[model samples]
Target: MSGGLVALLDDIATLAKVTASSIDDVAANAVKASSKAVGVVIDDTAVTPQYVSGLSPSRELPIIGKIARGSLINKLFIILPIALLLTWLAPHFLPFLLVVGGAYLCFEGGEKVLEKLGWLPGHHEDHEEAGATSAEELEKSIVSSATRTDLILSAEIMLVSMAGLSNEHGVMRVAVLIGVAFFMTFFVYGLVALLVKADDVGLRLARGALEPEDNRPGPVDNIGRTIVRVMPHVFSVIGVVGTVAMLWVGGHLVIANLAEVGVPVFHHVLEAAEHAVSGAGGFVTWLVETLLSGVFGVILGAVIAWLVVGASALVRRVRARA
Candidate 1:
């Protein structure tokens, strides 16, 4: 009886050690897979702030919270199950779906560019003015639009993350994916909440909310004022970065997946470009690749935009006739 009890205890110890090792492996794999999806992650971070840009300051964080919650649902309830099912049942279809998602990014990015260039019908300034007609309605609208966009972006993030662990154990893959999804939603939304409220924070500090009222002109005031002055410029920069990131990510996704599907022309062109610039260092090579990708994305996006816009217009006319 004593010998049997000793063996049982030893077996339990070994099982605990194995479980710990598996957890560590899942953590390491999750980090590695997340790095692979950095492009979409950055795009997600950059694109999110625009939804809350014109809203009232008080509602910004609440709006971000709602979007973040929706993002969690998207990743966990929607994308995860579908991705795992597809991986099990039809793994080969992922690249095609990625292409579709990439085209969406391109279309969004391209539409922004066209709108900015005055090629599209609406004036953004005017639109913003009209869009704010009702704060509640605007909040709901922004949240809805942002959530819809998050669905596509979240899909890409999960797919890219899973692609990194394609050869891993099934349990490990699912564990890592869940970790990445939760980490991304928290990090992206946390950063966005910060960015959206930066000006408010700066304003409070500029007024010396923490300092004694007698300290009329402290160094903190200067810091806060500078932040206030710089925030608009920062927002403008974020807008440009977000739009370009969308195009670059979208374009790269399409190009990379096309190559994966055996249509390697675009990928080969990018590779040749990289080779031509081999002596210029990795940064230069990357810049060249990005520019090419953006160009391709713009072209593809423009075509999609025309089709989408024209189809909408036609639908409107048909409705009007009825």
Candidate 2:
């Protein structure tokens, strides 16, 4: 009886240890997965403020809050189940979906690049000036528009985050995804709220406008002026950063997955480039890899964009003739 009790106790202890280890693995995997999707997260953060921009100050938080809730619904309820189902039913299709997502990201990034160069028409900025004649009208417009955008961006985020977790057990995979979904929605929207309010915070710190109180700049007062002065530039930088991140992440995803799917020319070339740069140390090698990926991404994106544009034009002509 004593030996049986000891064995039972040992089994219980072993079970406890396994449970603890599994929890830690889930957390570590969650963080790693989230890191992989940082590009989408950054773009999502940058894009969200436009929904609240130039709106009534009082309506901003409520608008952001509702959009955030919609985003959570998108990730937790909509995207999560669909992703799990795919993983279960047709695990083989994930790389293709990721390639599609990556291409979308690259095309978006390339659009920004081409738009900046005056080579492409932009429908993106036109979204901001849409009519919002009343608070209710504004809320509906912002919520619906932002949530729709969030769904696309959130889908990319969840899938990209889970891409590296294919080898994990099913329960671990689900837990990591759930953790990532919650954390990312919160992080993206939370930062967006802070960003939109940055100007307001700065103004209060300035104690007035961009200038300090009574022409005397205290540390806090100077900070206020700095933030107000810097916000426009900050927004511009964020747009650039988001674009670059998209290109890098998208390009890397495409290259890596192509290798996975038995087309490894680009991947081998990238590896060779990295090997060439290895003597410069780790950071330089990483930079070279990222730049090459971005370049490849832009080229692929431009080709896709051209095909899409051509197809659209052909369809329009056919419709007109019909």
Best by TM-score: 2
lDDT by residue for model 1 (151-265), tens: 9889888987877786885778889999988888998999888877888888888986445757575788878888889988887887778788778878998999899888999
Badly placed stretches (over 4 Å) of model 1 are 1-17, 50-59, 122-142, 209-216, 279-283
Give candidate 1's TM-score.
0.83
Report lDDT per candidate: 0.85, 0.88
- Cα lDDT over the full model 1: 0.85
Q: Count clashes in each candidate, considering only residues at least 3 apart in sequence or on different chains.
A: 0, 0
Candidate closest to the true structure, highest lDDT:
2
Please, what is the TM-score per model? 0.83, 0.88
lDDT of 2: 0.88
What is candidate 2's lDDT per residue for 1-322, written digit by digit as tens? 9999999999999999999998888888888999998889889988999888887777888889999999999999999999889878998888888888999999888888987887877665444335866668767877998899999999999989989787887788899999898889888889988989999899898885433346766788788988989998888888899989999999999998888888899999999999998999999999999999999989988888777778988999999999
For candidate 1, list the clashing residue pairs, or say none: none
